[model samples]
Target: MKYGYYPGCSLERNASAYHESAMEVAAALNLEFAEVEDWNCCGATEYMAIDMLPAFALISRNLALAAEQMGNGRQQQLVAPCSACFLNLSKTDRYLRDSPELADKVNQALAAGGLHYKPGSLRVRHLLDILVTDVGFNAVAEKVTKPLYNLRLAPYYGCLVVRPVRKTPFDNPEYPTSLDTLMRTLGAKVVDYPLKAQCCGGHMTQIKEHTALEIIRRLLKNAADYQADAIVTLCPMCQLNLDAYQDNVNKHFGTNYNIPILYFTQLVGLAFGISPKKLGFGKEFVDAAPALKKIGAEPPPKAKKPRPSKTALPMPAPAEED
Candidate 1:
């Protein structure tokens, strides 16, 4: 299916691997993505909090451009690969549709640039949502030439894309499982990760170093606890925080955590038999070689749980039972 693609800012730089892997996987899946012409930054997560009108206008400009490009096409969906971009675009559209006063002001601002947008004119969707929902797990499974067997992955949803729940959200906001199911379809084992939907400290890393390190440490520690080969995520910000700051977190916490943070698309490309270099595997700060090497290898045997001692005291009974 054809859709308008928004690579956002991170995809052009630090998260280039996400863009590369997405394109490779899209090609393998026979999906056509026409990039929005002259798309600008969606203001990410900060601009909206600073100034509402300009932020919405900036985000709406892309929507207007995408709508104009589609021009009567049945599919007017605009896909943003970055979590920040997706949330900004989706939030602006929702706000514009809900508040006519804000919409008028945003349109007035847009008019200065000879552009106008009507909130719901185009549908804003995240890359992961579209992949799992529109593409279908069965279709994705069919393309897996080399299954990611024996590889254990913790699917990290971060906290943005699924929050401030939409009228028709693709996945559960509190506890999303779409990514988990997608990983399993590629033959990878999905670990039980409770913090999958937790925040990854976004720009806080730049503002408050200590706080950011603590948050990053929690995610890394949780993934390590689950014995995951890697933490797979759809958000560029989450990957940046976890992968880029792992060493800093280690230093601050005095803990050694070598968990690799990989994009969901990278794993998809790998399962489709794409080469690691082509999928931009080495671009991440944490070395993914160790985790990638375990893809087809046999899983380690499970350790037996220790039996309770016969001399141990009996457990206390509940007050009601007593």
Candidate 2:
């Protein structure tokens, strides 16, 4: 089936691996994705809290663009790989449909660009939702050329993905099992993680790091408690907060937690027999080699190259390729 893919900002840079592996997995599954052209950010999780009208308007632009981009005969659904983008776009669409006055105001703003989106014109969906429901676990399991045997994993949904249930309405917000089931389909042993749908500190790591680390520590501690080899994530924000700050979390709590944080799509790509490098394997701060080795599928470490001169280029945060 074909879909309107909205990769969002993070996927292009920090989560480039997520974008790479997702494209690889979608190709393997025979799913076609036509990216939304000239798409902008969804205003993230912060903008809405700052200003409702502007935030909704910003998000509505993407929906308007996607609605216009769906060329005749293609489905009117736009799938987002980023949780923040999915939530923002879906929330704005739902609200615009629910409120006529707000829709009028947003449409007025879009008028300058010669675009107007009718609420409900496009369906906003998460990549995971499409995979589990449309693709089906059985169909995905059939693609297991290299099942992730002997690997123990904790499926971390974080928040936002399944939350605001009345709006999203697919999985249980409190305790989602879609990822758990997906991991099982890949032949990886799924751990009984209580914090499966828990918050991953999100931007709290930036605002109040101590609080964020505490929240992050709880999730990591639980995975460690269950002896999970790695924690699989659905959101890039969750992966960034947990993976990038893992060392800081360890230092702050005086605890040693090195569980590799991986994108669920990466594992799915691995199960499809895609090389780890192609799946963005070694991009994580906490090395995934140890965990991948358990399944006898660890990719060789990439060779380090000389750093670019400071005057020549600025490095990307959350680690860039060597």
Name the candidate that leads on TM-score: 1
In candidate 2, which residue ranges exceed 4 Å CA deviation? 72-75, 165-168, 296-322
Per-residue alpha-carbon lDDT of model 2 for 13-100, expressed as tens digits?
9999899999999999999999999999999878878998888888888898898989534448889999989888888888888889
lDDT (10s digit) by residue, model 1, range 1-322: 8888999989999899999999999999888999999999999878878987788889889988898888844538989989889888888888888999999999999999999887788889999988899999999999988888889899999998888646777888889999999998998989989899999999999899998999999999999998999999998999999998999998898999999999999999999989999999999899999988887744445556556588878876433200
* Total backbone clashes of candidate 2, pairs 3 or more residues apart or in separate chains: 0
- List pairs with backbone clashes in candidate 1: none
Question: Model 2, residue 46: displacement in angstroms?
Answer: 2.0
Provide the overall lDDT of each model, using Cα atoms, as 2-decimal numbers: 0.89, 0.89
Which lDDT value does model 1 have at 44?
80
Tell me the lDDT of candidate 2: 0.89
